[model samples]
Target chain A: MLILIVEDEKELALSIRDYLKGIQDITCDLAPNFSKAVELTELYSYDCLIVDLGLPDGDGLEIIKKVKTEDAQTGIIIISARDTLDDRLKGLNIGADDYLTKPFHLSELQARIASVLRRIRFDGKSILKEGVLEVDTVQRKIKVNGKEPDLTKSEFNILEYLITNKNKVVTKASIAEHILGEYSDMYSSYDFVYTHIKNLRKKLVELGCPDYIKTVYGTGYIFETA
Target chain B: MNLLTKTSLLITTVALTVLMAGGVIFFLSTKEMINKQVDKELISEMHFVMRSFDNLVHGRDTVFYEELTIIPTDEIISPVARFRDTIRLNVFDNKYHTYRALFFGFRKGGNNYKIEIFKSLIDSNTLIERVTLVWIGMSLFLIVAIYFLNKLIFKSTWKDFFEILKLAKSYDLKKPHKKVLLKESEINEFASLNTVITQLLERVERDFNNQKELTANTSHELQTPLSIIRMKAELLLQTPDLTSEQVRLISDILATTDRLSRLNKSLLTISKIENNQFRETEKISLHEKIRSLAGQFKELIDEKGLKISMTLEETTIEIHPLLADLLLVNLLGNAILHNPVENGRILLELKNNILKIANTGDHIELDKENIFHRYFRQSKNPGSTGIGLSIVKKICEYYDIDLDYRYRNNLHTFILDLSSLYTS
Candidate 1:
């Protein structure tokens, strides 16, 4: 899946790209400011969009609005250092699917991406099937070839979201907001999302499901059927 | 009550009293002196008349008697009966008297003679009387003039005082231009007071703004590194064929980053609360809000296997919704985190604008006074940042909500009095 990150902070943006790259087969486009983000939004089609509230030319909310207007189908997530509940609510109210406070773990981000994809693709469906592996979104259940498989909720959601998105790249911010919810914007914290994702991945491997979630370095995740 | 009015009243009252007393005393003393002088002159004139009688009877010397009559009697008796120009005379004698004295060619006699003398006094007394009247009138006028002058001075200064008060009422730390324009007072006391107030207000505004800016800048600065750490950890986790120890190490890094982020957020929240920066106000249902928060934290509560019971009253209150949400989140989060396993239980009750949350926990010895202080942690709980209750306390103070904490029988209870919320 293709994901676009619009942030002015070069180091942080590059790091986010690299983190998502480690997740799965995903392509990333980076925009440093509002003008660049607008240019990219107008030029390319992305499965998901990650935006920062503070931009050099304009506010990130405006960009999110523009992107939504351009591509109503594209999922938007706001990644900002503004961790206030009001900021989060405002972003969400403006049609951004989720909000990630700054300083989020990449694994958590991946998990969030998986969850958003699951919600967007499956709506409220309980079971998500991709080839031989099937994930139960609601009961946190997993199965491989119709056999019961052990998987934590985090793992199941991640696998389910990726499988739903299939070949689409999901950004780190999308994953973070989905798993951590409003608290994902906290820059120095990643424990909740990271620990859950680690446990989920471990359980998924133990359950003998083929590891389809691939990482693209410096970008995000992609679920490919081999 | 004001300074000028008070002073003017005091001066006018004292001056009127003194002037009236002095005027009465002068009038009485002048009258006594005139009466004494008149008696002395009359007695002298009687002697002169007796001396002239021998001349008149024996030698027929009328000029001597006439000269005695011309001797000034005005010093002894007033010549005017009214406040205008007029002159008149009269003489009386005892029935046994053989001769009498008269003026203007008239003779009257029989026993001893008695005479009354008067002359037009308008010309002589007019200037003195007018001068005295004018002096008294001027004194009264001076009293009123001084009183009003003082009032005028005080009114201007008092206006400045009111202006200062008004400026203080609307003082905004965020906007320094909103500060009052202080005028220099002619009164030393008022000027000094104004100076002190202005200085204090300026210092408070500066300190508050500095603290706010510091929190915002620090939070922003901290974000970049945290993001970098999180991203690096994700990159490491994505490495193919990572050993267990490596995975654990990466996971540990991620956890540390998460903790740091939480800490940063909490610190920022505390600063915001302290500065009273979050001013958004809304009407919210207290019971419904608490229930929603409880639902959100259900995963944590269930993980601890704690049974929760609630008794909520249907009431709506106006407050900053974020503050209310934070208050509940911290309290519930703390209860869940500190609850004893297995048979742990949490009971929440809301009624009469009061909210109570009680949870079963290990016995704790704490200094109640210090519990709400920032960075104060109880001896047994090392996981707490010590700012949760502090934040709650700040919210309560800002909203005028009352909060109390108590522990009894292995149950920790937090009571919040929300009466102010209802009133507001």
Candidate 2:
């Protein structure tokens, strides 16, 4: 999938581009200014566009509007330094798929990007599979080797987030934010993430599944598949 | 009393006092002058009668008239006239009337004679009464006229002042350049007041805009670099062959960056709230809000083995929804953050427009004065950002809610008095 990143901060844009490039199927194009963004959006079609509202030349919202008008199918996510509810509501009101504030976890961003893509492409019916493990994204059900394991809502969300950013280190903070909300960080406690992961790992291991989830001590959890 | 009413009352009192005193003095003086004139008339008439009697001394005896009476006496005395006021029955009107009389004894035709002449004071009394009635009527008219005239003058003079008050009451910093329809007044004070108020509003609006620009610039400038640093640290963690020490260092960097980002967001939220940017408000069921937040923090609560007891009544408040969420989250976060690690207790009670959250924590009381200040951390826990309570304070201030803290019965209690924002 080809994605467009429009950000005035060149280093931040490059980091996002490089981070999203970790996935084998994803390609990212960069636009450092509004005019360049508008030019690029007009030149090529993209599956999704990541936009920043504050640009040097013009408003990044205009690019989202233009891209949306040209192709309603293209997914749009606004990544802004402005975390105000007003801007978030305005971005969503303008038909953007999701809004993420700046200084976000790259893992969280990638999870959101994957979620948005899954929602648009398969209309929430997509199933992710790795060996004997299968997750039905639409029905929120998990299966391992033709058997089902009871998973709580939060565990399911955490599992999906980990699987989406599979092979990458997903911080406990990132998982909490993905499961709860952006403001959950202020709670400053990730013990719940540990508990849910513990239960999920026990359930999976009891169901004859290998231990695919690994803890990168003091950093975060990683979903390692061998 | 207001300025107009006070002035009118003072003027009326002084005018009535002066008018009453002047009326009484004028009536008395006029009565004395009229009595003196009557005495003079009576004395002149007595002289005329004596002169006429002298001319006809051998031809006429002593004459008797109602106004002039002459009587014969045996004793002879010097002739001297004296005046006396008398009340006599008038035959024509058949009523008692006041009279000024002059009496003298003289010797005529070798016989002693006395003569009395009287002048009635009826006309002078009538004149004084008419003058006094007219004075009273004129004074009444003058007082009434002055009162209304004073009111009219004050109303017109204060028109510009009232307009200025209205403009100030409706002043909004968001729309700083809104038209000011000020009515000019001839009074120097009011005109100068208008100029000063306009200048003040302009200055405030300029300051507000500057503050807003600073917040935005800070968000962009600071958050972008923080974002870069975090992303760099995150990328560094993904290196192909990293040692445990390197990972630990990277983790520290990420953690510190997260703290910095949270601090920046809190400061920005405070500035935004102070700027009155979150003007949208709606009625929120606080009972439901507390329950939802309690559910969200259930994991954190259970992990600490803390006992959370809730006593909530159906209460609603009008506030910005985001702020409402932030307020509850921060308060709940504090309760969980400051509680003891194991077997701690947290109690949430919402009753009668007051919300109380008590938790088992530090044995000593937190400083009441500085608890709500930014960066007031009671614990050495690195995870505590120390700005959560400040954010809560800012949100409460924005909605004009009263927040108080106390340590009693071995629990730290945060009491939020939400009566001002209570909609139900």
Pick the lDDT winner: 2
| Per-residue C-alpha lDDT of model 2 across residues A35-54, encoded as one tens digit per residue | 99988988989999999998
| Runs off by more than 4 Å, candidate 1 | A89-95, A114-131, A136-226, B1-188, B241-248, B380-382
| Clash pairs detected, candidate 2 | none
DockQ of each: 0.24, 0.51
Residue B393 Cα positional deviation in candidate 2, in Å, after optimal superposition: 2.2
Give per-residue lDDT, candidate 2, residue A152. Answer: 96
The all-Cα superposition gives candidate 1 an RMSD in Å to the true structure of 10.6
- Candidate 1 falls in which docking quality class? acceptable
Please give, for residues B114-228, the per-residue lDDT of candidate 2 as tens digits.
7778788889989998999999999999999999998898788788788788988887664443556666768899989888888887788778878877976686578889999
